[model samples]
Target: MNPFDPTVHLPDELLERIRERAPIHDRDNTFPEQDLEELRAAGYLSILVPAARGGAGLSLAQAAILQQRLASAAPATALAINMHLVWTGVAKVFSDRGVPGLEFVQDGAVAGEVFAFGISEAGNDLVLFGSDTEAAPTADGGYAFTGTKIFTSLAPVWTKLGLHGLDTTSPDAPKLVFAFVERTDAITTSDDWDTLGMRATQSRTTRLNGAVADAAHVVRRIDAGPGPDPIVFGIFSVFEILLASVYTGIARRAIDLAVHAASSRRSKKTGAAYSQDPDIRWRIADMGLAYDALPPQIAALARDVDERVDNGARWFVLLSGVKHRAITMAKHVVDQAMLVGGGGSYFSSNELSRLYRDVLAGAFHPSDPESAHATAASAWLGPLES
Candidate 1:
């Protein structure tokens, strides 16, 4: 059986385990180490590593489906695993270039190695704030990476590192490199990531003082061109769509919990279950509508991407619009879920609350709703006035 087969890749028993442990993982504010280990062992980590490198060689859409299912089981673990998947895509982009560090990823995945992304930086409110982590040229045609990366998701558990940054001094450099590093070379600090949601991500700060970046560690030297990367555009589209999928799943779960809560608890006045209440019914209907609307939109966008890839066309406007729409839908659906779940929803024990928080992170990612909206608007109004 193909490891990339969506139906077979994510088995029911694995999802059940994730569902069972997610609550405790959230409460403990620790990384979902065990869940990720299971993912690695199951070959889910190599889903995008390319066929040439002994991977499933799945398309972006298939990977998105896996992420959505995983997110439904455990959003925190899903988010961390998404990073690994994204890095795998990065590694594949460089495989033809004979990048060395990626071999470590492939070998590690075969031997069960976990990787994490270090893009966000400290003293910067926005993640991907030009990467304070600097890479200074060394005497031996290599670079030395030094500085701290904040919000480094899955840092404590990750065995490999994928970093993004620019050569600040040489701003006009033609090439932008996304480097890979081993965990043994860097140090992870004890900085806490006790956020309101996705508490189990362990997205703490990691300080990499004098981490060496040899030629082999450099994954890809992307030519700094005018337009966005086609590969990146495809990846971003997948990511945005899956964010909606996960949010929709959470909303469905919330509705289920609400239904149970209402059925068991009766109001004293009319002796009717909460489910029978008109207000509760209305809220549930709203949740259902929001959940129902997402898949069609995602399908339309996925189809557009496939068409673009076939026609050799890059529809930046359409891609950006899809991202904007999906993120907005996710936020709206999650909010409606919270309302339907009621005050008890705020309690940590209520899984809806955790889902609510994790869903919020989706809107805050790179190519978020606001930026996507801007890109769409820009595309609509023609080129910028020089």
Candidate 2:
């Protein structure tokens, strides 16, 4: 089995194509069709699939590195790609169980079909907790999922969807199942993703009224587990790191632009270059310092994950801390980049603007800064008796 290598990842050519299409994608707030096509062609969409199942057998750490590299070129493309990779990881978790609806997920991955998470719902303040969507068990032993899922990121191009919910009628239903649904079976609404940043993600609304899902499509229930699976935990940790990495990439790009602009642009009064100014140099230095601190912190977290998996320890607190630290660092880096880049960074033409917006998205994700901090603090306070 070939191990996934971020350094040797061959998606550079594909990423270059995404970069070419980014401006148009952003301008129109449309999905990066070209980018998705290239990713599918380059086998990037299935990078998380197991080796036996024809995937690249990449580790979470490697995936994080690759995401950062890709994000440097295009954050929206990286976001869409990340969603696909996450869904693929989810599919791998169910692969061994011979889950019904999930076979199509594997099939879609092999066939270059994209996947997205349909978690966020309309009028739901809390994405995870307040899902209005109901999964009712039918007489036929299948489930009928009827609800609207808003912010369905990457839905326009995704071939499959990962649906998360509980039995609405039975609020205390002991199990929570993450269902893998075929996109064709669900009704999709267009252009619902109107945001200040990451507009190119094409995260629209999906109406899944009466969508059918069977035992095969419905994977394992949450209560079926005794301990957290290392692979699943590792993958979740990777997502946190990847979120930071994408912002780190954006920050780096902003620094590069700032450097180039400072070196070339001269001060009118002093006849000195901006790069030669003490203030500009200090700001740039601050950006560099922030960027430098991220990799080591995130790498440390990834190493901790690897160590825990190796030692067979369940450390949910560690994962929470990693997510909290990485996201905080990402915010700091992006903020510093904006400060160093100055007013010109406000323009859409400036990559810094996009990076700024992309970094903001991290602050709002499910494992957001506030929740992560609370989780870590609670863990430090001591475990509560169940």
For lDDT, the strongest prediction is: 2
lDDT of 1 by residue, 65-138 (tens): 67767777887888777777666655554353443456666656656677777766655433332445667655
Top TM-score hit: 2
Off by over 4 Å in 2: 1-7, 91-104, 122-131, 168-174, 223-235, 303-314, 383-386
Q: Write the per-residue lDDT of candidate 2 for residues 1-386, one digit (tens) a residue.
A: 66555646545666677777887788788888877776777778777676766777665566667887888788888877777777665555445334344556666787787778777776555444434677777676556678888767786777667776556454557444567677555565666688877888877888987777776677544542334643345346555666666766666676777788788888898999988999989888887776787767666665554343443332545555555655566667677667666788888877777777776776666566666765667666755568
Instruction: Give the C-alpha miss distance for residue 364 in model 2, angstroms.
Output: 1.2
- What lDDT score belongs to each candidate, Candidate 1 first? 0.66, 0.68
Worst 10 residues of 2 by lDDT: 305-314
User: Model 1 off-target regions past 4 Å?
Assistant: 1-7, 50-52, 91-107, 122-130, 168-175, 222-245, 262-278, 299-320, 383-386
Clashes (backbone N, CA, C under 3 Å), per candidate, total 1, 4
Q: After superposition, how far is residue 326 of candidate 2 from its true place, in Å?
A: 3.5
